[model samples]
Target: MSESKNIEVSGSVMDGMAEKGGVLESPTKKPPTEYTVYPIRWLVLFIFVLYSASNSMQWIQYSIIQDAVVKYYGVSSITVYWTSMIYMITYIPLIFPASWLLDKTGLRVTTIIGSFGTCAGAWLKVFSVPQDMFWLGFAGQTVVAISQVFILNVPPRLAAVWFGADQVSSACSIGVFGNQLGVALGFLLPPMLVRAQGTVDEIAADFRLMFYLVAGFTSVLFVFILLFFKAAPPSSPSAAADLGSSLDSNFLQSIKKLLTNRNYILLLISYGLNVGVFYALSTLLNQVVLTYYPGANEDAGRIGLVIVVAGMAGSVLCGLVLDKTHRFKETTLAVYVASVVGMLIFTFTLDCGVIGVVYLSSIILGFFMTGYLPVGFEFASEVTYPEPEGTTSGILNAVVQVFGIVLTLTYERMLESVGDRWSNVGLCILLAVGAAITAAIQPDLRRQAAQHKG
Candidate 1:
């Protein structure tokens, strides 16, 4: 391949050096040696993941204290729900802009912007705690939701920029795992901190404290990202790192190209369906539990906690397997099938009146459903090689957000009309469709080999 063609295909054209024949020297000139920049890359990744966790923790905060929030603000359930729902809704319009920003700027600038937005939103919520200021809380959530557009698009990009080829999938998984861990913390913490049985005044006090804690944590993360996160290493860590070239070149063309790729589109839809269902489930778990098992709000939180924890574990395991075996297609398909089974088990066990069975089913459901995320994310990046990671990931997330909003609204209506048991049945059908679609995704392993060889 001509040097420019190679740069176009691999997305790694170095600046100015391409004019010297090629940015990467021919193998005969000097064998590529992987650069090991100890501690710095890992430290940057840690800060990014922490920021992701904080964003998620803020997103799910109101949901965890759902009843208390509604009572405290004297608002309807729909109003309280909008705090979380707005996050997905905002992504619909903002994700493309977020992607463009990530591609035009670099990881540091994009992430710092996002971190600051999250910090500002968190503190805004703290101010919203006094009097009839529900609107302030909504305003804060809207800002945080906008920040999510930037934060969610960068994990795969960060992993590609910082980690070696062999570790890329694993690293991506860790980045994703941090978001899920924050979600798990979101589920576990709020219920414990803001007691359901407390008087309205007492509940409001606890809710205020929760907001303060999240705001403080997010401020600390913002400071850390500002101080430490680097855009990319001084030298490329792997051939995949060369793909960073695409981040700066042909942003519009890359979007057009991604839309036209067959595998990328299929993976986009399949991944969206699976993740949309996961988002719906996460957002509505408290309602789902309370619907069938009336007055079991705490149990709902417990179930959510188990699902998120199990899902995080599943994400790490899937990432490790992908790193070792490069079995993206197979792993994704298997996880989809597992999710279907778990969904079936959970749906059937919902009203069995046995708490143990319900918990077990939820754990199983979470492990597989949540587990499919990293595999799907990495697979999308692999199939759409040479595209900016932010662009590909941004499109993926945008699609998932669209699906999430539609499904969450649809399922909420179904929960009222069809009841929780049948509402879950609908989710199962969606999971099965997602699995069938996943089966059609043929990963371009040749592209994988070429990326590694570069």
Candidate 2:
């Protein structure tokens, strides 16, 4: 763990740091107590919510397209897996480069570029390009990945910069809540939006309509960004000056420092395992139900629907808890533990006759499963010192994306070969290990932060 560079400074104190004196030397000086809130700061927060909503809309489109994608583009059941897998694969590699851009270019430019890329991808999907369809689809996925990098990494840093510490956790929670809400909508709305026709292609036409909807909304966001996003305030210095250039340490050296840090390494591994379990269970749940019972596709889909709503509620509640408690590490560990319990219920109890018990268990699992999104980022943002918060958060995201990449590439095959039940059980065990690793690293991180503060 490293020392965070973000410090608490009032306007007068900041002015004193920027200039030589706390007092403004003007033609006619006002009272020292005279202060006004920066309206743009509020704009930043409002736009954050909108940005979140737009980003969430993108999620909605994917969930909408998933079944349609399978019916039309899907050649095999494995093809169905690619919708999540390839998207993650293409998206995972972008995080490192995207984070670098965030560090170098600042938020406004990178975010707008992300929004532009996302809209482009969405538009590509909106039209039917039959020849070389897979590659075109891959391109769309690539752009979406870039869009996600900006969405996930930029807004939190924005909140951290513009708001006080007391407000940051709340902002982070609200931002994540918006994302989950978007995801829930994405999952919930698509079935209705992609109106069924007699043929798969006909349904896919409706899916394209949904893609247009997402693209149009994101395009509006891009326009808003062009009008409002700022790399720096009119008065603020360059980010290079604010946070010194990373050029002094070569890439390998910087990476070595990051990897060698005990907490960072553990955090990466923990999150990776979490991603693996989350994806494995998420993708395999339907299959698991079908595997256990041939006629259970509808049941599994219903269960997944419940999970999404429960997960959204969990995210909101967890955010509120994080805001009040600030127990980032402990909360994360507890979530993983709960995830393990949920996995057990899924593994063992699905066959039992207790319908209410299974539903409650599934919802509980969903709740614990996504608890990491906000807390994990906050922990990485706060604990990684010497490096900019973006750097830490970026790499953390990269790690998760890498797991996502792994999930895309190998999980289906693993599930097919090992059988869903054992694979899920193994994933649950692995997630428990992730929780333990996170727990193991917590004391070291706290000790380091305390030492730095002292």
Candidate 3:
């Protein structure tokens, strides 16, 4: 691996370097200090999990019920998807600013901003439930989308601050699990609660009820954040955790440095394409199913739920595998390529008119497709070992959203002009390119190298 640029995040100290023991020490080489893992970390993690799930639920809340939302909002299906697209749009510009806020303000202030934004957004949507208030709903969604910027980059910071080095990856996975679970509920709950076969007033009532449920849930989590979330523990959780970021590395400089790295750039390309396609597929999945199945809106949501639920399992399994194997490049390449295969199967199966096969193929697609998330995070961290995990991850996510916008547009265009079958074929070809890129990268596990030397 190339030498890690000495960039700091959240103002971590840059003076100390990792020694042979894998513990960073001061230049004076003071004797090791005690690091304690507080039980409160679980409470912190739990609240964050729910909070993340709540915010993410809003991301796909409407899209999963595309037919119903289009009618209730008196808008086009693309307009309904735009409700979800607002998330990608907001995330791109706000991620760095959010990272900077977390760095400057510590956990409490950041949590305040994220939690309030989430709760407020959820409730604000209630006011937009009336047919003419689509713009108002969009505004509320934009608020929640902005809050995600504060939330998505938090897992690494949380893990570093609260977990031992040995457990960082697992901690990160669990945090990500919250976000995935939220997406699952986004796919599952809205379809069940909101009615597709109802009068406009009846559908509006369903939307109102669903929005209230989410808003109530979000409000409770916001209170939990106020009561429990600490900025940091009284003591660090591990020796490595103790050696933290300083007010170094200008945010723009860090972005430039990350963009300049060839390996990291390749990662951005591969990860971005994989995630972008996943996002587009998830957003438009219902339309693809409806085109074939016709009026099976509930089953459309169920298919999406299967994809996400399968993805959650795949994510957990991959985390366990990487923990045991530490095979960053090999693991990522295998999963990335498999996702393409999964997509290929799903494409051919979608038009076969066999809903059962479609379900099975979704399981395969979701498993590797969503499974690649943590793998990408881990690989990027390895190659850019000493760079701030928060910044690297933030940039990585930003790239994914960029691809999300592009591919979602392309997929929608093709789905309209070419057909659902070929639109997915397009995704398969794109992911194949990503897989080849993944294969070409030289594996660098500098973080692990430092750990082994310890």
What are the per-residue Cα lDDT tens digits for candidate 1 across 105-133?
A: 88989898999999899889888876588
C-alpha RMSD for every candidate: 6.4, 7.3, 6.4
lDDT of 2 by residue, 1-454 (tens): 1112323333432343337544445747553331122446666666666766565455434333444455566445555555555545655677777777777677787778777877787787666435237556656755675577776666556655554434556666666666666555555565556643337656656666666778788788779888886654333222222233323433345556777787778888887777566655555555566565555444554566577667767766776786566677787788777877877877677766655566777787777776567767666655554455566776776777678657645656777798656666777787788878988875344312422222
Clashing pairs in 2: 2-385, 3-385, 60-186
Candidate 3 deviant stretches above 4 angstroms: 1-35, 246-249
What's the TM-score of every candidate structure?
A: 0.91, 0.78, 0.90
Global Cα lDDT for candidate 3:
0.83
lDDT of 3 by residue, 180-299 (tens): 899999989998998899988888889899999999999998888998887876666554454444336466777777888889999999999999999999999888899999988888
lDDT of each: 0.82, 0.61, 0.83
